[model samples]
Target: MADDRPPSGLRSLLRDDLRGESPYGAPQLAVRAALNTNENSYPVPPEVVADMLAELGETLPGLNRYPDREFTDLRSALAAYLSRGGEPIDPVQVWAGNGSNEVLLHLLQAFGGPGRRAIGFTPSYSMHAIIATTTGTAWTHGRRSTEPGRLFTLAAADVAEQLGALDPHLVFICSPNNPTGTAVGLDVIEAAYEAAPRAVVVVDEAYAEFARPGTPNALTLLAGRERLVVTRTLSKAFALAGGRLGYLAADPELVDLLRLVRMPYHLSAPSQAVARAALRHTDMMLSTVGVVKAQRDRLVAELTALGFAPVPSDANFVLFGGLADAARTWQALLDAGVLVRDVGIPHYLRVTAGTPEETTAFLDALAALGPEHHLGTEKAS
Candidate 1:
């Protein structure tokens, strides 16, 4: 018997704003060379795996009770790890959640809500808007530089002008931004902070470890700025996406506010234990950063040689244009056993910088597509 449920039942019951919204995610497809999600192609180091198993043995016995709500040890470990580049951070100034998304959600919950507004440059991580709207914060889609030959770079002046006009309560800046992997300069970050004196300026540095040398971290700016927050994730560089730990460094006072918004025991016992062990083996876990960066640069060169307008990247992915039809190219790649992200940009797709062999597979797939994939007169030169 067919059930006669109303077609729009859930939609009617859902919040009016969320009714037509699609959940944000990439295609979790199974393919030989999967580069769609910007995940590190390398698996966790065996040594780290053994260490995490040992730590889990101790933590498993206490699963009956709640895990440390504060995640004290994990915070301390993160603080120590982040201090490597001469920026000493205290455990008190750290916060963590299941992933950076939750951490961003906490920020929106604490600082953004009804009657408040947050602004993000366009073509950034889409979650910035999704998280803000879910928290009842109005979101402003600020513009990035669309100048001729520029790919998604944001200028400090543009940020300042937007902040002055919108007067938003929260500002999100993604360094080594998603889809278009270009890292913003520290000047842009500083400009955003100065433009909105009352706003919580968040720098989502989820791909910080993959950044080339001399790229300034926003954590360096937390010294005198109470409202500046820089969020990081172990998912990409540390190969701990499965462990699901993301954290931030900020002023201690600002860190305290996130507690009010996060749920109790948000970090589970196993999750905490695994992440702590991974941090302990940080050197081993991050052994792939150099390799990934090398591959990223290789992607830029190869894509450019193939006549695609590959954006310069500081992250583990490359966003390349010059395709006649990005969706068709995406399907063609998938058919050839490679996968990449379309990112909704016409004539463009973002592909993760995978292992050398995987990168070759992706490039070869595109090369195989030949001039048929080229937009205008540009061909592999």
Candidate 2:
């Protein structure tokens, strides 16, 4: 074998701050049931698949040419989709990237750099800090309520106070936040915006479609706020995760600034075609939302009945507590061929609301462990 030592080794070639850092990703194991990663449990409807095939076939021969640098048609489709919320948005206000993660990266590249700082209310999406730091922007770990049962709660005054003190260049507000599955109210969004006069306030609504009936989307608050941005994805609700289309809506001028950072024709023609085709069948693609929401409710109810404290979730996953040993429980579930997320929170694990069959598999596996995985104080009644 060739010598595989230092100099050419990754550690030696990596940046100083990135030397010991690990990339963010959930485990991709071959399991009977995978309730981790919060993917839509349903497959794309066959009709939508047929449409995507047709679009791809028509666009394939043109692959030799570069995709539209602006992805104008995709932007218009996204704009139309958002219009259903009763807030009409112009196509110019939309920006997209390979995924919502890449859209976030573009934001950091455009608005944040070495001298600037970005702040996020934690136990939120971990990627917020990761994206900020990777872009050379200082990352500030802001606090959320940590009272016994209020781990994911964020108050407007608390967020405003943090913003005023940290005065960061970017603020991430993950409504229907990941890991915890808790959503922040518009009051918190407004408070952060008013507190940080110069910061770009990002409201990540990746799971907005799964929110309870009355839950409002941050898109409603975008009328006149030039600094406010709401990022969403087709990955979660549209069953298009593999297509990797994530987009945001902001002021036309603000969205345009992202173009400065994005590589020319960053989105492939296939991606654009596939996303547009899926958008045409939005109703069918979203037919499972009600089913998913019902399953999510079932998870909350059943887990509560089992003596686990499942956080009230507006997203498609549930973050539960009362584990005697979270790591042990996580491994036991894996051993049983059921996988959930170990989100680094003590005594807690997050599981996605999948099909009834998958949900049953996860619940059955956890129940089979009996009292071994439960805290003595959390014994089921």
Candidate 3:
């Protein structure tokens, strides 16, 4: 019997792009050394947690009501934290969402749609491509330069050339980029902006706090640029991955445009309360930056000695390029009650720096695997 459903009347664009898409959940959690998500291993300070709980208890009276339509207080706090000297922010120049991922989506919604293109480099955070595809924006990837025996690096000239050719609507660059964990140079960002004067240039600095000494932040470049937007998250350096707080700093005019498209009461009161408490303890959060850096250097050294090709990472997680069998290595680590990310790229694995004990356990696990299982390719020069 033929099923008698009416002919679909949806737009071809929707049918073509999102016909079979499904929601995704976080990675599995097991009682192992979890180093996949780049989350801090430390717990929130007791005092901070107590303060947040107290604040939430006070706000219980309004729990039944909708949160503030505009998260003004939270935004003010975040703006102050981000400002160089705690100067006043226009407030109109601030925007918040569930996470920086959502902020990136809103930026795409503002600038990308049919016929317009969004551009990013290859092997970036996967979400950029996912969001662009779901939004019906044309997505393009620019190739990074790699001379024989050299590491992968983006060339500003090459980016300029590609931008000139594509004339995209939005350009995305992730500094201390995910998976690869390398920081993009200020010159490269400036050149990208120069190439696309009319396009919105988004610098996703989700890992900016982990950036090494002397690395330029995108915020320094946002003062005079009308089309530039910088997205940041509290998840990484602030140890607020569960708090779901993310924001964008942009030209006041641009931020106002985002408000028009953003859903009202987007941030819940509990989230706001916790984020504020975390912000008040900014010194403690900043202190983790140095600790993570030291751990990162140590992890790189240990991994290098074990004959793994760990990339020069400025972020909390590091990537290795010479895994003999990434899938097997990942499974072995998991079986031994240690878990790292298997990126599925040929011979590549990613490991987030964990606590001192977790780090030692990971090294011991690798050591048990012996040199025969080790992938000791020459380091990229």
Candidate 4:
């Protein structure tokens, strides 16, 4: 009899964008100080977890069925949290997904695709490019006019010039940007948004909780800006990284469009319960933020004193230059059981702030490496 089994041709017909992609693993299991990923060192509070479990037990009837497709209750609670400090927001204008990464993918799907172009600042978060490429959208990089080690301070004029020329379909700006942790001024953000009349501007405030008081929030600018969207994550300051809840606050029209493409039952019932309970205890999360900020400051000072040229940061992590070979330094730190992110930007590395004990261990490891690894005098690239 002839072989009736299907051929392996399905693999060949898969999307070209996903061909060689592999999972990005964390050094969590191996490293003593797990700082490679920007996760909170603090665990979720016990009371909050208990409360969520209690709620889940009570909601067992719904567990057998699909979760609320709209996630309406979670959206309202998030809106209330965002508006708690005098900044009002409408629940109708918010949308969420498994994580901010998903939220961003939906935005790109809604606004950018094959014929559309996505523009982002270089050395920003790497995910923007990944998402653009996977969506088959042309992705372009605009160099920030700041110094080599200063990736966070982009020139609004330079960005405007690019916007005038390319007129990209989507633009992404990460405030208190990942890796660098520096914030772009709101005026610069406004300038970029104004210049891109035909494009949608995405302001990613994943680390907004770490920004200083009085810093402009994208929500504060959303009143008249229909082309702007602000994406946030509870994973950061809310200590719910494992919960994987993220949201976008935008014009109701845009929010509605995102909802159209979002997969039904995107948020899990347990995840929703956990996030809502965490939000109810927002003050506890803020207390942890205070501790992280203080530790961040102390780490910056120590790194600078050690001649590492640490970049000024307003987030839970710090980036610095002066390593001889960042990859090798990363390896050495790993050998010493300390884990950090190597940006592969010649001599730059990023270290996320952890608990006091973990931070002490990392500082001791760097201190042992000493001034020889300081900028410009180390091994050749």
Candidate 5:
């Protein structure tokens, strides 16, 4: 549903689809257990913070000069970082932007435009549609397998059927999909690329670090596929959301073409410096991944025990159904100083896996709910 929330005077000047659509954001409320936006709840380690400050200090002297328009060193660092995925990603095969969203926007700007189409499955990232439409590329919302036993699984057959029907210019596969928290199989991605021979297929792996063991990332499929892209971010696992660094791995030729859509010196000096510094201490920056994952698993188990059905998540959040009233539960949690995401699902709400203390707070608040909140749950200690 398009949000008809924008003003009247700007309607004539704005793109028809965007005129009334609100900018995307989760609630930014202050709470005791703030698990709403899927951001890593951990602060950057003090040691990493000091090193980042040192890196920024060195860049202050060079601020007069524009950042490396090519982001040479940062690209090398990101390439090296991604190489840990076992695919040996070369710097030439990497392209970056302010964040993964900008990387998506760059992809849309380069390949998707007026008269072109971009397609992504529903219950996935909303940005895929927003960016496509805003870039003047028509957006086609795809569906997951409707068969029983499949909640949000995107099978290869689904990819084949959808691609055959739409033939879009861009195809987005968000593994460890948002809201639902389920990862897509590498087979599904392969099917998308093979089926959409004429389209650019993007796999958004912003939460790849939190995926369960044996969950294969699409980075392994990049070789020889010029149209396949795998985008990663330092925001979630790396605790670098403030650093605003996100990059993608693709064929060198594709990376070169993306450079065309980017403005001169788009990555600022300090932004590049901080990102490089954080990348250098990737281990320290990502120290909280295990803790977050534990809390995520705890959420799934406890929610199930509480009579709510929680989706198994490969990402650092849980989406639980069985809420008698999702909106009321959201408000009650807020009143109890806990915050979560409503995600537009009627009986479901998404909560980020936070610190152990935060997890306890959320569970305690939830278990306190009575029949007014849901019938499936028992309110007990």
Candidate 6:
């Protein structure tokens, strides 16, 4: 049998910090309804695909040379696209990476390291802690109330208290936080900045475009706060997950610092070309957002009606509770040709908002399962 131990029995050679760590991923399973990862289920609009292909085709001839190290034009397009959020941003203030995870890795690479620390509310983005660990930064599990009713939400006072006491060097707050879909308030972010005066505070807005009306984003607060960062992705709302474009908006000086840590010509020419093309058709790419949100809302109402407690979501997925066993329920759903995420939450499972028909597939699968799978979320709580 192949041993799972570090290759060549090199346990002693492996970094002590990385011991016992498992790489993060979701099941890439085939099913009739795949509502596991919160990916934008819609295909890119045909016209945008043509545009991407045309733009990328031009870049193909230049593969012999390194891509523009600065990625000037793509940055301009990203800034212009971000500005639609009611906040005008200069191209100098933006930087990108293969994915938001890499963008985060760059942040920790620059601002975090041995002898420093980072804090994030537990069950936020798992990668926040993962990146901190790999960078030799101490990961603090900033906790919120576990009491019933409040339900996975963070408060501003809690932010101020934990950050002030810990005095970490880097912090992350995810709006429309993953797994739970709870959107953090701006007041909490401001509190985090105030509490960690010397730290770089990141607001991860991967699902910002999916937020319902009146759910404000952190972009408006970037004006005077030099230490603040707002990270976004094309993977979710823009329906460009395969294109692998994630970016951040921050002070130009901070954007410059990332250059010190990043590899030369980090973005490939084709990557930049495709992203720029998609950015040119921002409205069309994001046209999927409304439909996804409608399905998201439908997931909330339907899950609740099915006796599971569904968290209010501003993102493209719903985390529903009241399972007798999340693992069993996940397997049962998979057996029934539907796949959902068992996010390690005891009684909860999260499902993505797919096309309306796919939504029906998931719901219908769940309805077919016996009630023994769990209790009502209200009753469970």
What is the clash count of model 6?
0
Q: Could you tell me the TM-score of candidate 2?
A: 0.96
Candidate 1 positional error at 227, Å: 0.4
Q: Please give, for residues 12-111, the per-residue lDDT of candidate 4 as tens digits.
A: 6778676657654455566689887888889887887788888888777679888888888899999998897577899998998888999999999889
Among the numbered candidates, top lDDT falls to: 2
Model 2: how far residue 13 lies from native, Å: 2.9
How many residue pairs clash (N, CA or C atoms closer than 3 angstroms) in each of the candidate models, in the order given?
1, 1, 0, 0, 1, 0
* Residue ranges of candidate 3 with Cα displaced over 4 Å: 1-14, 19-26, 85-90, 148-150, 376-381
Clashing residue pairs in candidate 6 are: none
TM-score of each: 0.96, 0.96, 0.91, 0.93, 0.95, 0.96
**Which residue runs does candidate 6 get wrong by more than 4 Å?**
1-8, 376-381
lDDT of 6 by residue, 11-38 (tens): 6689988877899999898788888988
Error of 6 at 347 (Å): 0.5
Better of 3 and 5 by lDDT: 5
Q: After superposition, how far is residue 282 of candidate 4 from its true place, in Å?
A: 0.9
What's the lDDT for all of these models? Answer: 0.92, 0.93, 0.83, 0.85, 0.90, 0.92
* Total clashes in model 3, counting residue pairs 3 or more apart in sequence or in different chains: 0
Give candidate 5 regions above 4 Å deviation.
Answer: 1-8, 375-381
> What local lDDT does model 2 show for residue 298?
96
TM-score of 5: 0.95
List, residue by residue over 1-381, the lDDT tens digit for candidate 3.
Answer: 996554366633466566666654436677568888889888888888888899888777899999987888888888888885343455677888998988988888888978889999877887898888877899998777666444657889999999999999999998988878888898989999999988999999898888888888888788788898889899989989999989988899898888766777788888888888888888886677777778888889998987788889989989886676788788888888888887657778888887888888888887787454555532331
Q: Give one digit per residue, the lDDT tens place, for model 1 in 1-381.
A: 996664475666888788668998888878999999888999998888899999999999989999998999999999999999799999999999999999999999999999999999889999999999899999999999888766599989989999999888999999989879889999999999999999999999999999888988888899999999999999999987877889999999999988898998999999999999999998899899999999999999999998889998999999999988899899999999999998998889999999999999999999999577889844442
TM-score result, candidate 3: 0.91
Off by over 4 Å in 4: 1-14, 17-25, 148-151, 370-372, 379-381
Report the Cα RMSD per candidate. 3.4, 3.5, 4.2, 4.5, 3.0, 3.0
Off by over 4 Å in 2: 1-10, 377-381
In model 5, which residue pairs have backbone atoms overlapping below 3 Å? 176-183
